[model samples]
Target: MSTFDTDLLIVGGGPGGLATALHARRLGLSVIVAEPREGPIDKACGEGLMPGGLAELTSLGVDPAGMPFHGIAYLDERRRAEARFRGGPGRGVRRTTLHAAMAARAKEQDTEWIRTRVNTVEQDAHGVTAAGVRAKWLVGADGLHSSVRRAVGIDVTAGTPRRYGVRRHFKVPAWSEFVEVYWSRWGEAYVTPVEPDLVGVAILSRGQPDLAWFPRLSRQLAGGERGPARGCGPLRQVVSRRVAGRVLLVGDAAGYEDALTGEGISLAVKQAGAAVTAIVEGAPESYEAAWHRVTRNYRLLTRGLVLASTPRPARRAIVPAGRLLPSAFRFGVNILAS
Candidate 1:
C-alpha cells in the first residue's frame, strides 16, 4: 500500500465524498479520496434529483450531458400532478452513471484515490488518520454508522430501526413527468427516469425488507407494462442518527429515511458542499448546523413516508390522506426537495 499525505482526506467516494474531493480540488486544497470500492458501486435508490441539489452541481460546474438521464415526473395512487417540475432540469440518472461522472471529475482534478477498505480511523487536533493516510482535515463521507464519526468520539441518537427499501431498474416510458412516487398503505414505489429507456424503481417500507410486493410495485410504474419477472430485496435500515465532531458525516452517513422520498442521493450531494464549505473556512459547526436545518425538512417528509409504509392499519392510514391532500403532503416534500 502507498502512504499518502494531503491537506484533506476523504474516506468514501460515494456522492458525498466525491463531491468533497471535487470542490476541495477547485479551491486548490491538497486532497485524497480513499474509497474502498472501485468505479461505481450499485446502490438501492430511486436516483431522483431535486432542484436545489441539481443547482449545486451547476455551481460546481459539472455538465450533466456527460451523464444523461430522464427529466422529472410525479404520481400517486389518488390524484396526479398535471405539470412537470416547475423547477429547472433534474435528472433521474442511474447510480452508476452519477458515480462514474463524479469519479471522472474527481480524477480530472487529480484527487488521489485509493481503492481499499478503511480498517479504521484515528483522530486528533491536527487531523484524522484513515487506514494509513493522514491529513489536516478529515471527512466521513462513509455512510450511516460512520466509522469516522465513532472514531472522532461523536455519537448519534437513532430512532428504533424500522422501514426497509429495495431499488432496481428497468426500461420504461415516462408515464408522468416528475419522478412518480406512488403512495400506498403497505409501502411506496418510486419510479424515476434514469435514462431515455431506463427507470429506477424502489419500494420502501418501515422496519423490514419486503419481498412479496415486488410484483405490485412493478405493475404500478409500468402503467400496466410488464416489469422484471424476478424480484428485489427489501433493503432495510434505521430512521435517523446524528454524528457530531470536527470530522462530520454527510448523506446517509448522517441519517437515513424512507427511500420512497427519493432524496437520499441528492441530500448527500447537498451536504457534501456544506461540509466542505464548513471545513475550508474554519468553522466546522456551520456544517453541522446547516445540515440539521436542511436535513430536518427531508426527515419530516420521510417520516410521513415511513409511517405510511407501516403494516399497522392505524399508522398506514396516512397514505390516502397524503394522496388526497397533496398540498399538505407536498408542503413537506417541497421544503425538503428545494
Candidate 2:
C-alpha cells in the first residue's frame, strides 16, 4: 500500500471537523477533510442557533440571507412563557441547508474533501496515521463514540443516558421569533421555525424518553395540529475525555452532554476554532488549556440542568422555581452559562 500525505487530516466531516478545516484553510494551512459521504447535510440536532453561533458564521464568511430557516422561537410549555428571536434576527434553517452552507464554504476555501471511512489510526511522537496516511495533526470531530477517540485509547466515562429524543417536520404557520422550550414535569420540547411556514419540533427527556409526551407539544406548535413523527435512539449522556498525544479531539468526540441547552453545535464550532488556534499558536499545551477554559462552565451548567430534570422530591422544586421565578431563574441561568 502507498502512504498518503497531508499537513492536517481530519477523520470526520461533521460540523466540528468541517468548521476546523474551513478555518485552517483560510489561515493558509494545507487541509484535507475525509468525509464518507459526498453530500452536505446537517447532523441530528434540535436546530437552534444563538447569537454567538451566528457570530461564528460571520467570521467564517457565510451569509444566511439565502439559506432556508430564519428566526428563533421559544415556548415555556409548562410555565406558559415564551420568546421569539424574530424581534432581532437569528435563524431557523433545516439541518440540510446549514450543512450545505458549511460544505460549500469549506470547498470554496480550497479544502480537499475525501470520501473514505478510516480503518484505524496509528500515532506516535510525530503525528497520526490512518489507512496508510500520515498527517501532522489529527482531529477527532467524529461523534460521541468517535473512531479516533477509541483508536487513541481514550475512553469516556459516561453518565446515565437520558430520555429518548424524537423530532419531525410540519408545514405550519409562522410561529414566534424565539426557540420555544416547553417546560413540563415530563421533560422539555423545542419548536424551531425553519422557514416561512415550516418548523421542526424536538422532544428531549432526562430519564427515559417518552415519544408520546412530545407529540402534543409538537401539535400545539403546528397550529394546534400534529405533524409527522420522527425519533432517534436513547439520548446520550455526559461524555468527557481528553487524551493528549499527537492527536486531539473536539465536538461530541471530546465530550457530549445533554442537548437541552441547544448549544452543542455552537459549542462544537467554537471549540473547533479554539482547537485550531491553540494548535497553531501554542501547540498541544495551549490547546489543552483552551479546551478546559472553554468547556468548564458549560459542563457545570449542563449537569445542573440535568438535575432540574431529575425526578425527585427535592429536585422537583425546579418546576416551581422555573414557573414562579422566570426572570430570576433566567438571570441565574444566563450568569452560569456565561
What TM-score does candidate 1 get on C-alpha atoms? 0.82
Which of the numbered candidates is closest to the native, going by highest lDDT?
2
- Model 2 spans > 4 angstroms off: 1-4, 65-78, 82-88, 206-240, 312-320, 332-338
lDDT of 1 by residue, 197-232 (tens): 667667765534343444545564554343442232
Worst 10 residues of 2 by lDDT: 65-74
Query: What overall lDDT goes with each candidate model?
Result: 0.65, 0.67
RMSD of each: 4.3, 3.7
**Poorest stretch of ten by lDDT in candidate 1:** 230-239
lDDT of 2 by residue, 1-338 (tens): 42448777887887888888877887777888877887865555777665566668768976553222233223333434322233234556676777788888888888887788875888777777875568778887887767888787776765664555666766776556566766655777777777776777777765554535555464655444555565653445344455467677888888766777676777777788887876676376677667778877667776677775676553445546655766755554443323
Give stretches of model 1 more than 4 Å off.
1-4, 65-84, 156-158, 207-217, 220-245, 308-326
